[model samples]
Target: MKLSPRMQFLVRNGLKGFLWLTVLLAAYFLFREVVITHKPDAWVERFYARPMIIYLIYCFSEFFFGLIPPELFMIWAINKGDTWHYLFNLSLFAGISYLMGYINFLIGGFFYKNETFTNLKRRLLKDSASQVKKYGIFLIIVAALTPLPWSGVSLLVGSAGYPSKRFLKYALFRLLRFAVYGYIVYQTHQI
Candidate 1:
């Protein structure tokens, strides 16, 4: 009558999944009812229609600073409805994110040249580069897939002088993260 350890873990996870599914269904029904009773405003349509504005905001937010959470944009894409438009927006966001990571990689090289910090924290500087060389790529993918600061990971890889071609090849894993997140957000919100 007792479950094995693996079975226990599976049962616990199944229960969690059931709970989440129930909540999501309830939310979906509520969302449908609200949409039926109250239409979205005209400005809402206008804003979503303008892809350029959204792309600009995404680029600036991602590149200059990781200021805005990308989920907001994903949700926006879901609300936009047309499949092509949503896909376009999501792809644009992912591309910009990748480019920003590359830029951060280059910016990291600057730390090596900055004599002020090097003088103050020689050991710290040397150790960081060594650590990156040792474990940067795996850590980079993990950071990209999660909510962690992927920009910092990119910088570390660059600082370690990891080859640009290798970084590009491996860092494409970020696209997978985008695809998975986009699917979940879109599915949950879609009618």
Candidate 2:
């Protein structure tokens, strides 16, 4: 079967968009060393030991996204003290993750919008943006729950200037993943 001229144009445009998105994702990993590494200071470690501050610190850590497994943070929170402590940990993480995601949202919206990847980015986000629009929340939850390199996706969406309401909706879905995983950690602690 042969594609008409119009079909060809669409195919070419879609291919260009796919390639650009791949490159954008790859580029994020290329700088993963700088982009993903987090070294907690001695003071921070000491601070977590205080029991009262563990929940607050764990939330802040999620803002880094790919820096570490969220399970580790959950485990730390579960280790705190009582049911109130667990709820506190959940709240802390939620606040931090939301704020952290916003930073990436802005980074996508602003910092990476250079001539370096201009055409490709425009093609991917602009042309293929609809593909995500339908299942945005599902995707965000998956990204938050799994160990995938989802921060890049968040950044791309942000860069493309996806509406803030859409972004928050997705972030809330992702937060559920974190909370579910935290529950898992808490259960494992009992046995």
The number of the candidate with the highest TM-score is 1
The TM-score of predicted model 1 comes to: 0.69
lDDT of each: 0.71, 0.60
Residues 1-191, candidate 2: write the lDDT tens digits. 99865555445554654465466546645544463335435434665568646544554455555565555566556655677777777667656766777677777777446665567766655665564554445445555545543466677566655777778776776577667767766777763
Count of backbone collisions within predicted model 2 = 1
Write the residue-wise lDDT of candidate 1 on 1-191 in tens digits.
Answer: 99865555445554654565466557656865777337667547767889779878887877654566576688788787787878887897888889898888777667545676556446666576666666666656665665455676777677666777878887897788789888887888777
Clashing pairs in 2: 108-159
TM-score of each: 0.69, 0.58
* Runs of candidate 2 exceeding 4 Å displacement: 1-61, 112-138
The local distance difference test score of model 1 is 0.71
Off by over 4 Å in 1: 1-50, 113-123
Determine the C-alpha RMSD for candidate 1 after optimal superposition of all C-alphas.
7.5
Name the top lDDT candidate. Answer: 1
